[model samples]
Target: MSQTLPDFDQITDTLRALGAESEAAENHGLLCAMLCTMEGVTADAWLDIALSGTGRDALAPEPPEALVTLFDETRRQFDSDEFDFHLLLPHDEAILAVRIEALGHWCQGFLAGLAVGGIQQPESLPGELPEIIQDMLEIARAEGYELEDDGEDEAAYAELVEYLRMGVLLFREEFRRQYAKAGEGSIH
Candidate 1:
């Protein structure tokens, strides 16, 4: 059965309590994306390293049990057929509450996760992933980027988020297909 997704506030609060700077939604997205690129490792294993500061020392902190459950639920949701994944962005009464900087942080965390998973080879990446990844790196560096309060800018931001969501799904499918073609076993 499909499980209820974790509440964003709860997850974010938990991350904050754990001294984590990355938002839960971005963290989950990054982890899932890395999982797609991995050859031999389960989500739990990756989470342990991620929480242990294996890849980046600045992000080191032991996540609370609730945060662990959040990660598990995120993995489960990605593996489900519903594909109802929602980006962990805040929406103002109508406008998206998340700033452009937050998206940058999400992308930053994602690249970090990818590096930790040993999927940083641009030559091995298929499709526009390389370009997107590069773009994400640049976006991660955008500190003072500002968005106009117009509806058009909001639309553009929404489109970008949607593109990222699809990118995650595409990477997952490509990796799974590659694994199948290899006729190898997953490290699950």
Candidate 2:
């Protein structure tokens, strides 16, 4: 939703040109997760670090401006109240054309990003946060299911995507709450 985010192809190409190791969907998912975990970390800083780190330093050409613009748009979308956070997944047509395992990759990338962003589990999690994270980990390892022409598999996939979407929002809220608590205790 939210006025249609950038297409996966453009993102994939941009990341490829920058010599990023992860694919587009997973890479963006990782960024989103990092944003959630790092609290006040800026998008620009994350991009710089990700691009300049490891095998990416050999890339001669600078990344396209559009890539930065799209990333900023995604950050704005997450901060906006009108939109529900949707995972940067492949479009249905592409998914139907081939068994794209972008969802699992996205989850895997998200977990990696969270870890890299220095996410630390609280001694006690609030609400269903722990379960939600566990579920995402399981989903990261899930195999792609065939989409039956009858639409059953599609329907199931849609539900799973919805769950992923809601989980991200919940995770954001929980992280914020935990951060606020830490800030509060520090001042006391």
Candidate 3:
């Protein structure tokens, strides 16, 4: 697998070509959340959600090879202790509004992924996770922002992204600790 993530636009195009209803950012969010919350989340399971409502079975469509690579690399990043996971969003060059909207979608997808991953009660989760989940819920509900083309919005966006990245890492770590305490095997 490649060390770096696949191009954002390329994954978006592939999703479109595969008739996936979810956008790349949202799909990626779902993938990340599932990886963080669940014990065994396969690419096929992710595709089942990502490709839902398209009237085609995920396997029947034979998702593009790039998508498989994307899943592998993303899983690898999450498994590593290097903190290399990243949200799949538009590059810095994209319009701020577009990026913000995508961020909301990403958060929405993440919440949905938690449900899909069998996290029945996020509020019951240990430590600061419940608060973080609440914050993510608020972010998912955010609609729009009134702002200029100033650097402030860009900086805020960067901060939000970083917060999300760290929050997800924390979730993964906490869950892994729980599993370890329960005498469960590695959550791969």
* Candidate lDDT (C-alpha), each: 0.66, 0.69, 0.85
- Could you list the CA RMSD of all candidates, in the order they appear? 4.4, 3.6, 2.5
Superior candidate under TM-score, 1 versus 2: 2
**Which candidate tops TM-score?**
3
lDDT of 1 at 68: 66
Tens digit of lDDT per residue, candidate 1, span 55-137? 33344444466656766776666677777655555543434445565677678777777776567485558888788788778
Candidate 3: regions farther than 4 A off: 58-61, 185-188
In model 3, which range of ten residues has the least summed lDDT? Answer: 179-188
Evaluate residue 158 in candidate 3 and report its C-alpha lDDT on the 0 to 100 scale: 96
* Clashes (N, CA, C under 3 Å) per candidate: 0, 0, 0
Off by over 4 Å in 1: 1-4, 39-44, 53-65, 92-97, 185-188
For residue 92, model 2's alpha carbon misses the true position, in angstroms, by 1.6
lDDT of 2: 0.69
> For model 2, what is the error of residue 61's alpha carbon versus the real structure, in angstroms, after optimal superposition?
7.7
Cα deviation at 187, candidate 1, in Å, is: 12
Candidate 3 on 19-72: residue-level lDDT in tens? 888898899989988888777778888887888887556446576787888898
Superposed by TM-score, candidate 2 places the C-alpha of residue 118 at a distance from the truth, in angstroms, of: 2.1
TM-score of each: 0.77, 0.82, 0.92
